[model samples]
Target: MSHVANIMLSVDPDDRPTVESLSRWLQTSAPLRGHGPGATGRVGPLGGTTGEDTRRGDGGFPERDVYAGALDHADLDELIAHVERLAWRQPEFVHLFVTDQEQSSFRVWRFHGPKLRQISPEGREEEVRPAGGPPDIHTRFALAGDVELLRDMVVAAVNWGPGPAAPREAVLSDPRNAHYVDGWPRPGDLGLVALATREVDRWEPAPVGAAWLRHFTEDDPGYGFVGDDVPELSIGVDAAQRGRGTGTALIRRLLRTAREAGIERVSLSVGRDNPAVGLYTREGFRLHGRDEGEDSLTMVVHLR
Candidate 1:
């Protein structure tokens, strides 16, 4: 199959050195073309599709540019190497995400002068890694020792977003949401934390995501609660660590744990527009119901 790379760069409009450097790289290095100001809807880097107009302002930056093209395997390698070299020389201003057509490969190299590191799905930065391998992503049963960690993850999970995030205080203050972590591991609470292994400078594994089950009384049912015997689910994954299958892994493992513990089903309430809706569906969750005027979905998966 043909290989293609879609590269997006967020750059300051006034930074002539970086601009010229990018122009020169496109002109001399690979099969890709740089599309910036006035370069609207031109041929996409991956070809066929129209390119997104990057001339418009984005996230406080006046402009961002895209470089895309189909390349032979060798040329794709050279292009990636070229980007790494540029980042090595100018790490401060280099913010890039490069991925292939199939999205089976991605690169967002972290550079420290001459040194280069890759951010694994688990969030650790490792030096000079290869393109593809099973991610170091793994999970462990959360313990009583992780009370503080779970509390922090509760916030992380609630505030997780690719769009507007609710204020932390607002999320925690809600009675419906507060029950997830308020009691500090109630009698039936069980959870697993997805860890990315370790940080570049620290020895402890960093928590990137979490999934847990908790029982609710019929009088105070969770938003997704179906019955007093069914445990409601709560999950959150780090914003940076998402889209790499960490959430899926967490859900699959957590469901297995629920089944092993003699639980027959688990349920969760999620916003309709959340990206994870597709993920939940793929993992066997089916819509249970939705309350009137509510924008969220109540979904359930049978573990029996």
Candidate 2:
């Protein structure tokens, strides 16, 4: 059997130090030629198809495609454009390994025809179709709890992994949310719960709803609500008040707010085994995903 190999180094325009470092590393690690500073060079065995044959000296390894050194913002844009051009010009190059020393993240993207596929470190695979649109990236939060919750979240996060899964426990222990002290909202309990972009225009709260807000304020005090582009809906009721329907009312208020703002969808995470899951489901929330450590279900509701 005969195989061909080609190695290419793509660098950002602003990172000269990285280019120099990589050049030295490649020189010592493999057979390569030194080009000028911040320049690409090629190295290879004379002529061999398979890597095994190249190792045996039947032929040398493949030549590398050298481009400019590390990239900057402008260079990154140029590089992406160049890659897209290559995809159109030469469709045979299927595998691309991208390393960003600037960002300290490495990604391997595979091209099949016009489609790109990203394989996550967790072994999840997501596809990017060229015709449909650009690639989509997401930020994932791990919900941790005790041993039992962790075990459940892990099973739900991925189907397989060793050890107990405790995403919430791990998160709470990380000293980030550790300083969180539970208490009642004093006189200045007037904190803002910024609505998400989708919720901003839809729902309106009645002045009388202030009394209803007491449930979320009194029980889930302390953590001021998040104010990001994607608003998180989190509600908690006092342990003693569990069966009294406080949670249900709080969610109803939130849904009302979302609807008033013209937001059609809302989502939240609750432990899978928790009774709250049933409440959400009964109220028209559908399970979207699961987190084991929190033993939670990521649920979403859509209002017409």
**Most lDDT-accurate candidate:** 1
Residue by residue across 42-98, what tens digits does model 2's lDDT show?
322122123333343555543332332332111222233334444133334433444
lDDT of 1 at 131: 21
Taking all chains together, the TM-score of candidate 1 against the true structure is 0.53
Q: Model 2: how large is the Cα RMSD against the reference? A: 19.7
lDDT of each: 0.62, 0.36
Residue range 1-304, candidate 1, lDDT tens digits: 2233566554433334554565455554444222222322212333212134323355342343333343332233345466666633346555555554323345564455654444433333221121231154656667666666666666776665566777877878888778887876779999877766333414234677778899998889898888989898888877777888777777777787688779998998887878888989998999996456778889999998
Residue 189, model 1: Cα distance from true site in angstroms: 1.1
Q: What is the TM-score of each candidate against the true structure?
A: 0.53, 0.28
Model 2 reaches what TM-score against the true structure? 0.28
**Residue 68 in model 1: shift from native, Å?**
53
Segments in model 1 whose C-alpha atoms lie over 4 Å from true places: 1-134, 198-203, 290-293
